[model samples]
Target: MLLYSSVGKLSAATCSGVAKNITLAIVLPRYNTAYPWAWPRVGPAIDLAIKRINHDPNLLPGYSLCYVFESSEDDSGYCSDSIAPLVAIDLKFTHNPSAFIGPGCHYTCAPVGRFTSHWKVPMITAGASAYGFQEQKTTYSFLTRTGPTAKKLGEFAVHVHRFFSWTKQALMIYDDKKSDNRHCYFTTEGLFYELQKDNITLIHLPFQENAEDLDYQQLVQMIRMTGRKTTMQAGIAFLLPKRGEGGKEGKNELKKGKEEEIWRHFPRTVQTKNLTLAVVLPRYNTAYPWAWPRVGPAIDLAFEKINQDPNLLRGYILHYVFESSEDDTGNCSDSIAPLVAVDLKFAHNPSAFIGPGCDYTSAPVARFTSHWKVPLITAAASANGFYQQKTTYSFMTRTGPTQNKLGEFLIHLHQFFNWNRHALLVYVDEKIDDRPCYFVAEGVYEQLKTVNISVLDTVFQEKEGNVDFHHLLQQIKSKGRSE
Candidate 1:
């Protein structure tokens, strides 16, 4: 939740050898769209946490805390999109961090989780509520999260449903294209099933692709088909889309126009009836834009747009803002304080550093501390290759694959599929366009080259707009045959 800074004065102990210096790597997600929401809280939280840890004499006696920061800017909403580049950057750092902190989103957590699990590093995350963390029972030793569990989400839904008194006929709308949707589905359905023990009617309206437009239309159709007089309660309505601007625009249009249109068809008296809109903040801070005023303004604008719809039912739209407080509870900070304390207790033979998240801190901090060879201890980081090779090291205390894990999988695929014999690498250019997708593609290319696999041909795709898969696929096929 909240992170605070404190200073404590203590008596000096007996003299000892040089104190070990620990480097903590905090990796932050760098999507321009999501940064506004995440950085304001996460950045300040880390800064305050580190300051508090350093000031605590008992926790880190002889050693001073060093920090490494990394950023993954892939806006595609896939964990691998950001994790791969982050891990590649971490591998380049000279310091061998003892631990790593985050790849903020569940999508980023998956790849980072796999990598840390392989390297036996401690990984801790403040967010990332994906079910896989518990369902798969990841073997990574130090994996943990400070956020609410899926079951808690179910409970919240049940309360909302009970408040509405609409036992049955609940509609659930989710973005089928994203993994986050699965989380929403399970949590909502679990709650619905439990509440329905009283014999309520629940109608599941699941939309798979083009969630913004298509799904919204499907939901309206279902509402209409249920009849205008039907007092229907809807479960979590994922108004946000996976993609950045593209998704936002689509969602905005739907909630602004189509949602109201559906309401207009209903009788005026029924329209005046209360309709609850359950908005779930699956990933904290991600819902808001990355900038300060912009973040605040964007949320305000979104709400205003939704409210402008005259058809919005009379029941208040309950926006449950589920997020970690900024206060320093010490739960997250305590996890890494001991490691720093231990390093100092051991006469600083091995330095200690602690971090809160992986994608936000580790890579950047690693880059900064590469020259010192400082070790970092993290509760979690979801970057792909943070611990690859012997140079910079990260102890992923939690579960997730590093870039190497994904690279290893690619290597196995190369061997199994024999695609390594001759391959055509298609990637977007980074120098002219510094996108996370290009960075990941390049990272994968470098890994493939390490195994004596050379790219027979390279293709650069258009940077902006929708990708023309038909032409791109044909080109890839042509190149494959030529090679």
Candidate 2:
């Protein structure tokens, strides 16, 4: 599931010389937490594309492209059939939309595409990549896919299988059998079906995707028990004699042996003391871009490189213990992060904290690291407070840009363009701890106000699902801005 770029260009090409009042019903998920390509993350880029297309004289000739957004997701961050169909019906009657840009999730996309295909209206999406979409041609005849499909993924997996020459495979998948939550099931169904054609024994192990009471121990035991007879088990176990610094049998063990002849080639004086770094992250199963599966290997590689170098941190060896700040549902908790920090502090005596990458989760962990006088390094935690509250998070070090820097950059942008006035629409869900847009809007507002730019109005949306687009549009209409 990758978000393809040049959405504006694609949209422009789709709606070229369509009509004067050409409106596209743009369906998007409200939050980016669960999916990175959600509307909150990609909405601005889409808006900018529309803006550029509208302003360009040669592009559309006389026709100007416009969009009406319909947030496709419900409160739990899954696309809702109940919400989307109603919204689509309303948009169809009210806006008289020329086309449908998206309803990215397979759940919403399926129904919406049915409507569009019947209406002879073209609907293009960067999501809805399930293989079912490919098979259901008549239902989705007018639908256009702009992203990777599960069919291609299945083909890719087949290639991998052939390359490995594996005769048997255990296909462990997070398969939720619910209507809205069957993304994993749909994605893997292609692979499962494709593998059935091959000459290999495959075991499909389906589990609850996000159940809070999910039995992890049972899952582990099940993995061990499944296809145990056929799978070859190979591992190396180290047997260290009681001849260490604190060992009681050290004198006796020392008398029994000298270094082996093969050991003479290596430097025995290399650092032996282990320095533990607490590696906090979201769960590996979450499929987030920064989750443990993506980040853990990088951390291990870095530690490997550092520990291999004899001069780097000369007296100590580098190691890490991974801890998840998020649960199965993908919600990062402030409390969980601190608890992880306290546990790692005592258990591993960690020299530093590597993450808790979420902005909300990073706060408590940062405070803990600051109190412990150990550095908290992260590529995330880009909110304004992290940079502003220097005294509170003095030991916190960011490897990337903060909201303040973004605010500063926006200020320069406004100044360079000589933009005087603009309206601000800030979405802050009090229910959700991750309010990235709110923080960014705050920073942008502060910076823009400093230069005496006329603030027409600042609209605050408390809920993503409950945003009154009609009221917002009315406010803009009342402000007398035609653009």
Candidate 3:
């Protein structure tokens, strides 16, 4: 959820009638040396970025960029959400900053986000990555995330588990009882939920710091015993060790020295003889593009060629079943797509999926395929949202250009023409429709915002039976758009 707000002209002016530099209050855990987010690590990067932004004549045109740093004071190692916001509040009133760009810890960023939203101030950060931040629209409406969130980590974990065909695992979380932010616990909450949703047997273990009464050796022995039993019963035992001791170092040592131990646990078996591929599309319908006549024959030919080659899929024979994504109206239906996917999954136990090619239809079906750990390949569903493979559109592979790429092309074209100001006109159909223009316009608008292009006005026209070009033209004219 990346959001950037343009800094407007300030009322105050210099004696020479020059506008003052726009100030951004940076709130970070600068004083906290225990964490990597401390000033010594991230401050130099921020300084360099600000210098580049100020130097760029193409961005923010008349206005200069400046910033002041305020320590959020996460001195206790874990970020204090409450303390961070109070610091922001002080800076907000004192500096009257145009925007904010810090509080880089997820725990600290969230509270400050709530304040910024209410104040109608934009806040940019590389943190606040916990899963909750993705859905809390009202609370973090003014907040912009410059980095990937924990939700992607959760989805990637699920993807990795499915990729390895692993059915069981153990996750270890560190519980810092004295700290306000339990970084490990909050970050992996989404991962635990995903594993549970997949019906995978997940053993969750949490240990507190400096618990002298707890027997460390006995705990390790218990886990080792469990690993042996799990291997015998489930044919796999996966354990994620804690940091500093048996984490990266242990895994590296196992890879180097314990090759025989790993091989004994994971014995090689014969490849699966058959794998089903579910090909979903508007098989008989021609209401939209990508009808079965257009794409089905090509898919069939490709599969036939692959199946004929003995070395392609080793000894496994690829089989495919066709399912229609069209509804009674002869159009691709989002509702029907998932039902067909579920039916195909149950009947064939497919290893992969293809088509349900329409953008609306493919999205919902993609979610199901991602959860089932099945790859969904399509030349359609070219919306910008599908680019988010680690989150909503996990397991989806696009074999064609996406709207985001189109937006990028448009941006380059605009830059070439030196078009800084323009009016955006989007035509949305009033009746039941695919909303092609709305999706394209949305992607273009977001892309334009990143480069600080001035959009004079956005006009949305609902097209019904009779098109009114006069009114739309008049509306755009009223905005006095030059480009």
Q: Rank the candidates by lDDT, best first.
A: 2, 3, 1
**Model 2 agreement with the true structure over 1-483: per-residue lDDT tens digits:** 112222233233234465575788877776744765587777878888988887888887788787777667766767764455546655666667899877877767766776676567899888877766776566577999999886787678677778877656565554223555354555555565556567656653444435455686886676566643222112211111111111010111101122111100112354367677887877654454467778776876777788779788888777777677764356665535554565567667778888888887787678657755799998889888787778668899999767888878977877887767767543323445466677777777676677887656533434446567888777666553332
Ranking by TM-score: 3, 2, 1
TM-score of each: 0.37, 0.41, 0.42
Assess candidate 1 and give its lDDT. Answer: 0.43
Write down the worst ten-residue block by lDDT for model 3: 245-254
The local lDDT score (0 to 100) that residue 188 gets in candidate 1 is 45
Number of the candidate with higher TM-score, 2 or 3: 3
Which lDDT values do the candidates have, in the order given?
Answer: 0.43, 0.63, 0.62
- Evaluate model 3: give its TM-score: 0.42
The lDDT of model 3 is 0.62
**Residue 217 C-alpha lDDT in model 3:** 72
Q: Which segments of candidate 3 are over 4 A away from where they belong?
A: 1-272, 458-483
Clashing pairs in 2: none
